[model samples]
Target: MTMEVQFEKSFYPISSWNQGSQPYLASILFCQGRRTTSLSDIDLFAHFCAAAVPNLAMVESVDDEKIANRLDRVVASIGRKPLRVLVQVNTSGEESKSGVDPSGCVELAKHVKLGCPNLEFSGLMTIGMLDYTSTPENFKTLSRCRTEVCQALGITEEQCELSMGMSADFELAIEMGSTNVRIGSTIFGPREYPKKEAN
Candidate 1:
């Protein structure tokens, strides 16, 4: 059996890589799709990939209130294929964000455990703060959340992967015990932001 692991909320760049490398590869499909990702969307995506490639490993993203029902429904629909979920915690506490607060991630993780027994609650996922200087603190906050979640769930720290790093601040994340890092710029160069027109 092929074991696959994925980095969460990788944006389009990471998704692009997974699209190219399927079957026995860990593919991360973000929740920020055409609209908010629903259970049906997850079903379609997972089913499509599993059909095309038998050995594919998939980790779907979930945030806040949608975490419970969405995960439950998806796992039931997809059947057993080593499904894992990325619990996105909005460490920045932005209004437009979808994840639970870092302070409350343990409660969220507990809900995930109780509600979606079929899916494996492999780890916690957070998008590092945009401001590089503040990224380390954000990672620490996520670390605290992961600790609480592990304690609540009675899972060993070794079994839990606190996915708290990204293209930015990957080294700090490593220092803080981030098992996975979503590296884009390092591999693909700087992202091209939309150019503002001349005033």
Candidate 2:
């Protein structure tokens, strides 16, 4: 099976790609569509690729050429099949977010398109500011990146998905043309972050 998950209209993706997520993939595959963003663990990336779900996932935290190139090599060695990827854009301009800046987005996307043969330059994704709803500015920034990438790559806007929004702002995101939204929390409840230990 190819990494065939498509971020089609109203795509609802689960947000869990940790080591513990493997067993659940069997059941999750029954959904019409599924995706996992915030895939930040570079080390686990190769491990997942070599596992069972490699053909059913997309990496969304790819901000630089280094990470994209690394994925290319990993996929090349694993099965030489094309893996889908979304160029993460730091539209909020927050230092803590893991994504490419608005200015360099097109350049990085170009690398993914022409440079990474084992990868499919699928679309663009972003995390809005944690404290706020999906701001039009953030949506606009990602939309602009998508437009630029489509124009530069000779692809249509529809072909380049805009994976913005979450459960909190999915309606607004869909209104603003977000093809994909992460809504796992809405179904499963808020995440339980581990408590920090005292020093």
Candidate 3:
């Protein structure tokens, strides 16, 4: 398609490589946004478990211990194939946000790490100010959460990821220490290109 998809991180969404991840599913390939209003979380997990190609890797919005325990139980029921999870943080302190308060991130990370053997505490994520440009402080807040999550769990920062950023401000997010980003529409959707010369 001659489109440019740019980013520097462990995960990259390149337009040229669209629909090319199926071959690499055996590796730890995480698909975000499994939750929907129509289906409960457990129901969604069940479907993923029952899928012919069940590569349900990481979930981004685990905000509390209750959810962590519930998901842990589900993962246990399906043998030892563990689910990687990210503890969502409400960095901007928005009342409308779905994640746990930033103050509670460590406790949640600990619960997911020590209490839930069936689930891996992959990292932290946040949906900062709903705009084209997110506040840099929001990114810093997530990085701080990562610091706390790592210290409390005795794990290195690399072990705990920071999944913050989307298409618009992903570069800035990365500059502020975002490891993973969600860039779906920017990659799969239309792109602007210069017109070709007349033949």
Candidate 4:
């Protein structure tokens, strides 16, 4: 099991969560949501590293070089190994989603592999359209991107993971060669968001 921790103040602290589940967890995934700038927040990265879970960070934009550089610095300063990075591709082309365009996913993955020595280029991920039934196209797009990325990097599929699917479509994702799936709601039920205060 991999835990998806939203790097926000309201979620239960990662350290506490890790203590109970570390042995069972494959990795701790830090999802930045639409807040791409949060990826550069060194304190957040440090907080996660402290938990000692194998870390995976999701990037929702195409500017991988900047994100990778920031992550490298943060990990290095804390004496932690670089976090595995996933390039989130906008497979559905929805205005509400966060990710690089599908057309640019290979380029971003290649950038992380070659340009960011401090980071491990783990793989590609995509949050499909809201409709659960429409996930196959997104999975196929990610699979194709992964194949192209692996070919370009001269590495086998095992070297890179495909982080597609969530609670709803994980079974289908696994059938289509997904190495990682985020299934928080299915296991824990829907999350309660902190209410916003008036400005």
Candidate 5:
């Protein structure tokens, strides 16, 4: 199974400054995939606010209202509105990728807009197959999903940010209209994982 990790928690230990103290650029806290029992939605949202990081919580099979209600409470707590959010879509139809199916993206977006007033409903994001280079088909799938999501939400494509690319094929992704690309490894080099010890 694809591990569902908090973006901030993974990076916080190594960073020099606090979450919101970055002088030059802003950061986003992406909590992708399912919500575990240990971390409730309220806790996650509070962390997002406390860290002052924009959140992109990728919803899988969870009920939309549950997400909306949690967001509402978060807004109340922060006394702020319009939190940036992304609806992750499984454009590749890969079981390994963590996101809602393409068919369900529009409905989820709609729910986020109509049901979750606190969320800004920024756009859509997806993680394609790692082995495969970003292909035209993959781009097309995301484009279609974005179009549908915008239409369902009565918004335009320009308003929806398409975050679909990584260091591997960001060039093609840019040509295909990816507003955001994840290029950490390309700039920082490959991450070193700790080796396992024998039991």
Candidate 6:
């Protein structure tokens, strides 16, 4: 199997390619909803081509405080140069969820842009709280949250990228003005269950 296929098999969706010692491109390779593991170095920039290929990367399970901390680190390491950073906010009102309060993300964005002049504050990314059955309330909550976050960051609606839909709610998200929709099950079919550990 090709490296791309191997990546797909091991991580399901996250894709990265390295040609020789140069990094080619890095896009969001995989997403496991709200709670997800952080990407590896290869996933971040090992084989990335920022100019040729879109090196899209996202923060896993983001919160205002965490965003602030990460922004500080990025600024320190990369210095004050505009860097594209996609902030993923998980807006599930459950303890098991992986994001911060939607409104709170605005504060995080502001801090990144103002405090970390190096980061361009590209847009907002989010996964709706998982619900067995879809509801208007679910979409409504995500829509409202997106709007609030954009407002907090003082970003124009056109500039704000709303990433709040997946295979289950892609249509809903599009209808609700989702800029990016992550499709998984639709393209790959249902996933197999991994072995579970006993308590």
Best by lDDT: 2
Top candidate on TM-score is 2
| Residue-by-residue lDDT tens digits, candidate 3, 2-77 | 1122322234543333221111111112234434352232222211211112235556678888888888888788
Runs in model 6 lying further than 4 Å from the true structure: 1-61, 75-81, 132-135, 196-199
lDDT of 6 by residue, 1-199 (tens): 0012233325433333222222112223343222224323233222111111222233323346555566556555754444555555655666666555665667776776677654566566666667725434555665676577677777776665555566666555555565555554544456667989999
Using TM-score as the yardstick, the better of models 1 and 5 is 5
**Residue 144, candidate 2: C-alpha displacement in angstroms:** 0.9
For residues 149-190, write the lDDT of model 1, one tens digit per residue.
888989887766666555556556666666655554544457
Q: Write the per-residue lDDT of candidate 2 for residues 1-199, one digit (tens) a residue.
A: 0111232222555342222111111011223243335323211211121112334466666788988898888888888569888888999999988788999999999999999999898888888999764477899899999989999999998678777766677666766777666654654457678999999
Global lDDT of model 6: 0.50
lDDT of each: 0.56, 0.66, 0.65, 0.60, 0.58, 0.50
- How many clashes would you count in candidate 6? 9
List runs of model 5 lying over 4 Å from the truth. 1-65
lDDT minimum window of 10 residues, candidate 4: 18-27
RMSD of candidate 3 to the true fold? 11.9
In the predicted model 2, the residue pairs found to clash are 3-55
Give the TM-score comparing model 2 with the true structure, all chains together.
0.72
Which scores greater on lDDT, model 3 or model 5?
A: 3
Per-prediction TM-score, please? 0.65, 0.72, 0.68, 0.68, 0.66, 0.59
Candidate 3's TM-score: 0.68
Give the 10-residue window scoring lowest on summed lDDT in candidate 5.
18-27
TM-score of 1: 0.65
lDDT of 1: 0.56
Residue 195 deviation, candidate 4, in Å?
5.3
Regions of candidate 4 where Cα sits further than 4 Å from its true position: 1-63, 194-199
Residue 65, candidate 3: how far off, in angstroms?
1.2
